[model samples]
Target: MSHGQQTDSERKPQVTVVVVTYQSRNTIGATLDSLRESCDAGLAVVVVDNASNDGTADFVAAHAPWATLVRGQGNIGFGRGCNRGFDLVATPYVLLLNPDAVIAADALTRLLTFMEQNPQVGICGPAVQEPSGELQPTGALPDPWKIMLRPILPGWAERDMRHVVPGERPQATDWVCGSIMLLRWKMIEEIGRFDPRFFLYFEETDLCRRARRAGWEIWTVGEAVAEHVNAASAKATGAHMMWDTIAEHYFRSRFYYLIKHFGWPAAVTAELGELLLMTVRAAGERLRGRSYKSLGLRLRSPILKLPVFPD
Candidate 1:
């Protein structure tokens, strides 16, 4: 590189990356390598291991001695683990990353530049793709109906359709993919921490929802890219069982959100409809020879609760 170019590169803003891992020994190294290539020497990388028996901590320390490893007290879940790492970060901006995700070489700088260009944006997320480079839905405007209808209805019907398309163009979105979200320190300070009530799912949407309500814009930096190994952490434990629990938690959290904002009647209505839909799907899947065990059924009893609100 030319001297002027090298000097300009050296003047880039410093970033602190916080990666939360749970049984990710197989994929963490690749993530670290990608981050190393994307980041400068001054970047502070914090890896919080959620008590993995796979020797994740030692492996990380030995491989990347510069990284600060925080061994989790237990599997405190994703949002909580990220919060733990966030406490240690004092940088102007922080990147919340998953161990199974890899950011492009220019992702950090591009995202940082985008945030710099748009002072109104408090949180920015990059375009996300699967390991195969297929575009993933990285940003969406959060709404109860939109979240519930995405699976039942076609893409055109949903209010947040931009996410379903693949591109490298910036756009305003309700929420960005938590797997690779970048937040300015000022926003994090003003909004407080992520709602730990969402042990696993919906935490990102909740935070982004709050950010939007607080008059901050959330943007998707389409030029920035990250390859995410979807559900890497959830799959580590037990895909079916873990996902079921996450779904239940999501439903409950949804109800909790409704109750807090819209009152109890709405919360009850939302909860009942969610439970009924879950039961029907579970029953259908079980009849397909998927096995009761695969459906989180230990002898045909339902794994979740289902009852009308008054009951």
Candidate 2:
């Protein structure tokens, strides 16, 4: 062997951080700045702008020339834009970061170290912190029952019933939120990437489900942390639209996820339950003289319009 040659163990694993942006001008700068602080020489960054006209692409080009920017893809939705960015990753690790989330200085390094030690872990996520420093519920398996009961039950009652809480121990989870995730390239080779059918929500859940089914572990490293300004870009986009487009998108994704995973019967029952719950809530709101525009809009979402089971 040559004197200067290095073995695979001696070589640091490279990572590519993929951020999908859409009108995320305000938050993208902070996110990039934090990434710069967290990343080492082995780290590369890619920003895929979904035809954002709010100077998001321009800002990335000017301020973050080190990052590879892919623009003019015309709002291809989160999952698809992420897939496009994934196509550009040449690293062993791919970190999918939300445009509004900022990793702590040692967060990326910690995640990488953990993954290196545990080859069986295919997907790992950091403990997400809200701007207030409170822990967000980033690590949880999808609970179809809780999701269904949420609309009908009081918040405190639901919390009591489910004992829903975040933990500080690094452990396996069903799925972590997509706000910040570190994925193994080998796992991608085996299970592929996020399902393009999911335009926004539930895509991460779907991906994690597939990975678990394929015998890879999904874990959340509680010690590694990131601060996320949740849904900043989505809120910005929704500002231009009426009738809570975000909620509608969520319902559509939920229906697709349920049908894809649990089959037609489960999806239909859940959809009907959701419709009934929303209708009751709307009536109660009206009786109290409160506006129920958002509830009404959700009740009429396209998910409800679709046949309970697709042909």
Candidate 3:
């Protein structure tokens, strides 16, 4: 048989890695290079650039010609861009990777092997570390308890808090991070695709919740890993204010999620608590640094008009 043509038993199951880029010209190359080096699994790629004026599409075309590139007509936001990439890929498994993350050589292999062994696991995510090799709290179940505590605790602490014990059989979750997430074709068919209502944040959480309701299991693979240059796009794109705006959307989505899952009373209380907690937490962070005064002006500059508590 030809090298490309293997017996059914010998063939590796295919996985298409979908990366959505929005003005990620500098970092996308590194992300693609990592995939090339580490991905031995049957590999395909789809790069969807969301109306980036930074020549992100041209950069991908030149540097990663192997990838199928799609230049979006306008900024369609994160979920939509990813869905577009997902549509273009023709693999049994779809790996939704961020433009800032680089996969470990065995990451895809490990994730796929686990999913195959555990047929109930419709979606899986790998442990993500920072470029400096520290664990970046990437994936966790969105428990009501965790969400409440998140504002009080530090980022690392919030991330490390697993809602359920690890190594237990597959279970449902509110959502997992979009970074380095793996999804089976079956799950997509059953649960439906990501809801594009969210322009950026909480998009994954909303999708996972729907998947769980549909009886799909979300899995976290502790062994598989990736290095995520965390939040590079957010910083590079000068969307620091956009971060807060998206955060408001996240809280709004939480209210929406509560209404969808629970009811109105719960959503109302949840929204109030979230608003108060978020405001306090942002204040606390400013206090910890000596730049509270400077941070005030920055907070005021966003287009979304987030109210700053009188400091």
lDDT of 2 at 181: 92
Each prediction's Cα lDDT score?
A: 0.72, 0.78, 0.69
lDDT of 1 by residue, 1-311 (tens): 75556564456546789998888889999999987765554677999998898988889999888788998768887788889999888788899888988886677788889988898998988888885556667455444454333333436435455552434677888778788888988888999887776566667777887898889998888788778877644656655533444555555555556555556665565544544545565677678966433223321332223211211
Please write out the lDDT profile of model 2 over residues 1-311, one tens digit for every residue. 89988787556537899999999999999999987754554478999999999999999999888889999557778888999998898888999999999886687888999999999999988888776555656444455565566666757324522211334667777777888999999999999988888877888888998998899998888778788877544455654232455666677777788888887787777777766777788899889998666565765566643213111
- Cα displacement (Å) at residue 205, model 2: 1.2
Model 2 scores a C-alpha lDDT of: 0.78
Q: Which candidate should be chosen as best, given lDDT against the real structure? A: 2
| Residue 251, candidate 2: C-alpha displacement in angstroms | 1.0
Please give each candidate's TM-score: 0.78, 0.82, 0.75
Candidate 1 steric clashes: 0
TM-score sort, best first: 2, 1, 3
Off by over 4 Å in 3: 1-13, 37-41, 138-140, 143-160, 163-174, 233-249, 276-311
In model 1, the runs with Cα more than 4 Å from the true position are 1-13, 138-142, 146-159, 164-167, 232-245, 275-311
Put down candidate 3 lDDT per residue, 148-210, tens digits, no spaces. 445555474366555323233444444567877899888887787777665666678777777
Quote model 3's TM-score.
0.75
